[model samples]
Target chain A: MFQFKYPENFLRALGKPLVVFISRVGELSEFIARALYSCVTPPFYPRLLLKQIINIGFYSLPVVALTTLFAGMVIALQTHAGFSSYGAESAIATVVLISVTRELAPAFAGLMVAGRIGAAMAAEIGTMRVTEQIDALSTLSTDPYKYLVAPRLLAGVIVLPLLVVIGDIIGIFGGYLVAVYQLDFNPANYINATVNELQLIDITTGVIKAAVFGFVIALMGCYNGYKSKGGAQGVGEATTNAVVTSSILILILNYVITGLIFTE
Target chain B: MNQENNKIEVSELYKAFGRKRVLNGVNLSLKKGESLVVIGGSGTGKSVLIKCIQGLIEPDKGSIKIDGFETVGTPRKDCEKYYATMGMLFQGGALFDSLSVWENVAFGLIENQKMPKKQAKEKAIEVLRQVGLGADVADLSPSEISGGMQKRVGLARAIATKPEVIFFDEPTTGLDPIMADVINDLIISSVKKLGAAALTITHDMASARKIADKIAMLYQGKIIWQGTVEEMDKSDNPYVRQFISGSAKGPIKVEI
Candidate 1:
């Protein structure tokens, strides 16, 4: 009898989670729509925008720089080792240039920032929610969406591309340093190879990816925090969820965007 | 009895969290410049009632009227102007930790009223002084202050706009006896001074007696009894008597 019900039970268990996931997606889409609507409406807050830009962009530089730099160096070393075995070691510069601009730098910087800034945004907003500070804003006649969410969304869209551009340059410089100093490649030749391999498409793709990743990071952070309940435990869960969801979304979206952009 | 004289009029309010049924068919009203206190035990939906009035939480079914204007289902934009005339002090003070004490107080003036920063700061300082907080404490962060001081700052912030109506949620929940009395006094003086229609929700009977022109006891999502403080002393209702005397064994059962 139990064996006969096994498939039905399995389907039921799957159905519940599928329903939950779909509803969550719906809620998130509505949240994003409202945030975007607030973005386009009047009563913008430049001061808050500037503050968020500083917090999300300027403050994230060290981690982005360090992560991309190390990633680039490691990619250079690994490619060199692989290609040296086949006597194609000179291709190291080309590989480093393409990978840094097209994939590694943006993804690494996004993931790093997701961990740092996403968690912070969730924690801060969750605290505000539980403490009734968000309600206070409403009673004070300030729109919390316009004041909190819009500034963050706009700042993320504005500044992530800038951060990624800087990250790209720093990452390439890391590759250059390793090729010239550690790998015994001539500095001028390596530079020439890197310049020749770099493409407009490569740079543009990274910039676009960075922008989407930024939006995802900010969105997950704000959504989780704003919806958080209970208390300290709720905030803690929200922060963790923000970081995890944004990081996963960064990776998944990277692949999706890459596929879409590169498709014929 | 006069609808025109009522500052707030709520009728048949219903709110439920899932199947919990937090508030059921509630009705109440506050007259102009009158301080009405809602008393209830834990989990009794007093906060929900106050939040529903503030437009922070939309009730499932109800009519909430401010100055005879129906507010339920009104668009936030249509109601924006009304918020300018209203103020709230949250249970936990709810001061924005990111902002300094003065900025917290002056938030409504600078943001909603578009007053200049310097003028708002001066106003905040003056309001802070009124709350018995010194001007020196204005520049400090809310975290640097004690719980009592933070409550005072919250009160100052609530009254900074000189609102026509004010709501306080658990105004004296976390304070010592002396500090609670001080807050009770501040609340009384502030409401009197502003001549604002005030609604406060708290379980603290002492604070309620000190501040309320009318006291209503909330039980299981309904106002079971309402009367003046003097009348409350002589009420025959078992719930009212039990609550007033703070008796554990009574018609009101502790959930535990």
Candidate 2:
């Protein structure tokens, strides 16, 4: 199958760089999915890995929550100001919740968390790698994938859903605050409109998107770190790649997932 | 001129980075419980040779037989089992920053062997004590320790599994002479106590003399000379003599 695209001998002769790059991407995705699979299975490292999860996951609540809140408020004010000039100000609450719940919550939370934490994961693992601790781990008979890559991936999938839920709430509340207080919309009416308009699917879709984004963030981090070669320069390159790839992936995937979820 | 007995046997090994050969037809063997140091100028692939034996870097062609198990291109699964009986002290002490000292030492036992944490911790401390470190250092992060202390901790971690073979990559490069000797002494005693074969790579002749029963000199990707400590002094190889004497006025050209 591989030979159809390139000459068989030519591909085989390409060597470690070729294997490292292609397998790097595949192994990263597999590493993440494997972690998720392992998390759900037995012999769990709950206490140990959870401490890592809290580090990777819960500690970033302040940032995710804060960003969502302001984002929601800004979104509300913008939606209201534009509509009110057109004498359709009443559509503000509907627009705010739809945008916050369906669009902003998962996208913003995943991007924010990825920016803040993905670099740390890549740099931490990348440094371990460059310093040969990963080799040390192997010499000690520990699988670096099972121990290091698994924990990061598992936490990303598990924790981002919760973060997305929080982001959704904070984002809606931010929109509510702006709509009621700043936009001069009736508080009860705005609340009623938001409540009526938000279906179960809206929240579910956004949370699902957040989970995928979380997985991608972690995948990028681990891939960059795992594939990182050289010394300080390589580690720096990996850190940059982790953050940039996670951000770009979050945006691209958000559209793909949203289209699938929301299309009639 | 090996004495016909071999502990770590490497034959016809070859490795390359892109088109540049790092190890070219390298062949070496050391006897059981013997300390062999490979000395060479920087980037002469001294480290690469040790890595091949340790299975850190797979050789493109050759055989590395540790207790008769062929290591060249050994599958990663079998590689783990091969690694369980081996230890390494990375040039920079490579301790995991996220793990506390005790956890780092206990990493193998807990993760690979599935030993209980309590037993692993106890074993980790015991090994730490063997390296002249107190058990009190266990809870601290690796970052909290001084370079010498960190080196000791790395030594502790290396010997924790009581491995059958150990590789020390520039084991004393960054330490002061006194600390270097301290590490050298610890390496000797611990290897003796564990009855493990030890291979070290370094430019420090003092360290090599203190730790090695035999030494080899690698130059331009080949083993130019190897001998007992007594023979090392009388070695006719220009590279080995220049290396052991630390002479700048020799056939060696410094890359400056």
Candidate 3:
């Protein structure tokens, strides 16, 4: 074994990451369950949860809406140009409709929402941890998770789906506008075509996908924030992790969900 | 003494961070309405010890009896009932910036007690006044205040619910000596006024003598010396002498 020279130092460094990984897993698991538990638990902090719902969920709307709209337009243009050479231009409506609703809308919406609200949650709680308010809250007879993490996760899971569903609708409309007005498709026919082309399964699958992505974003955000240690640098790392992990998880999960749903 | 009625008991405690041990077989008692100051060098687990008792950092092995109810590994739900009796002034004032000073002070009362805002604000003003801040200052933001003022607000918030116990983490570390003494005097008087048990963590000896009825010097994860303030000057422990006098050349060498 090559453990003679650097043994102790290697063990110490290795222990931190292992503990960190385990701690993060515990935090995420607890938050997900507790958010569900607190729903039926008496003495619900409804006012506090409402405030968080507004802050983390509703406030992210304008950005998610705008980003989805623009993304939908770009996808439309890209599909139009590519399909033209293959003489498959007539199928552009179905292509844009499926891709935007099932994939782009949910994926980009999750990523954007994750980057915005996820970073803010991590930074806020991370700062609180470093500053010792989390400890202070404990001394004051409050559960920091119940008081802080629960509401945020509750709002994220409950609200992001609605936001993404709205985004899916808005994104499809964006494609329609580009298709009808600029791409020279008939306006009424474009609208009718989009509706006819999109099966209920496509729309339902996208909404379900958005819900899963929402869970991923909230889980990553709360986990990073709850386990945040050290000071400014640690908070920065948690915020960065919230964004990176949520985005990656959203992409990866999208593929899995798509395979399961579309294949069946 | 009637003050001893307010004491917390610790017994046969052992804690370690992996192979590097901290809190090796520690035991002590802090009396009611009495102030105990825990002083130690940097990295000596002074904060860790306090955190352990408060249930922030769980100890590997120990018994912490708060007013006689043992707190070792108590379920967090039950811990909330225990927490209702404690308050803390963090190393840096941890006032929530999103709220006004009064709101920060009223956080617990409103959230936990479900007290209405008007009643909480009225009570918050009373506590703020007790800490020497006027009612007019209660509306200002925590960031808008000076460091000393923030500490005062933090102190006010700690005593707001009138908890039976309070912990001060480095209350005087960042202040000028004059301000530090002011904080020390405020802490002493407020603890006396509330008749609350106080446990303050610091390496500041000057503040220790002024605020603590008992002094415990922690080093290498253990309370190496514990005595009444008067007895500390006569104690012959080399580590205690070196730590109290601020001498660089001693048994306690800086890692540098």
Provide TM-scores for the models.
0.96, 0.90, 0.92
Q: On TM-score, who's better, 2 or 3?
A: 3
Q: What share of the true interface contacts does each candidate keep?
A: 0.94, 0.88, 0.88
Q: Of the pair 1 and 2, which is ahead by DockQ? A: 1
Clash pairs, candidate 2, are: none
lDDT of 1 by residue, B1-256 (tens): 8989998899999999889999998999999999999999999999999889888889999899988878899987887777668899999999999999999999999987899999999999999999999999999999999999999999999999999999999999999999999999999999899999899999899999999999999999999999999999999999999998999989999999
TM-score between candidate 2 chain A and the true chain A? 0.87
Best by lDDT: 1
lDDT on C-alpha atoms for all candidate structures:
0.92, 0.85, 0.83
Please identify model 1 stretches exceeding 4 Å from their true place: A1-19
Q: Each model's number of backbone clashes?
A: 0, 0, 4
TM-score of chain B of each: 0.99, 0.95, 0.94
State interface RMSD in Å for all models. Answer: 0.8, 1.2, 1.2
RMSD in Å for candidate 1, one decimal?
2.4
Q: Give the DockQ-based CAPRI class for model 2.
A: medium
lDDT for B191 (candidate 2): 93
Rank the models by TM-score, top first: 1, 3, 2
- The model with the greater TM-score, 1 or 3, is 1
Q: What is the lDDT of residue B206 in candidate 1?
A: 91
What is the overall TM-score of model 2 with all chains considered together?
0.90
Alpha-carbon deviation at B13 in model 1, angstroms = 0.6
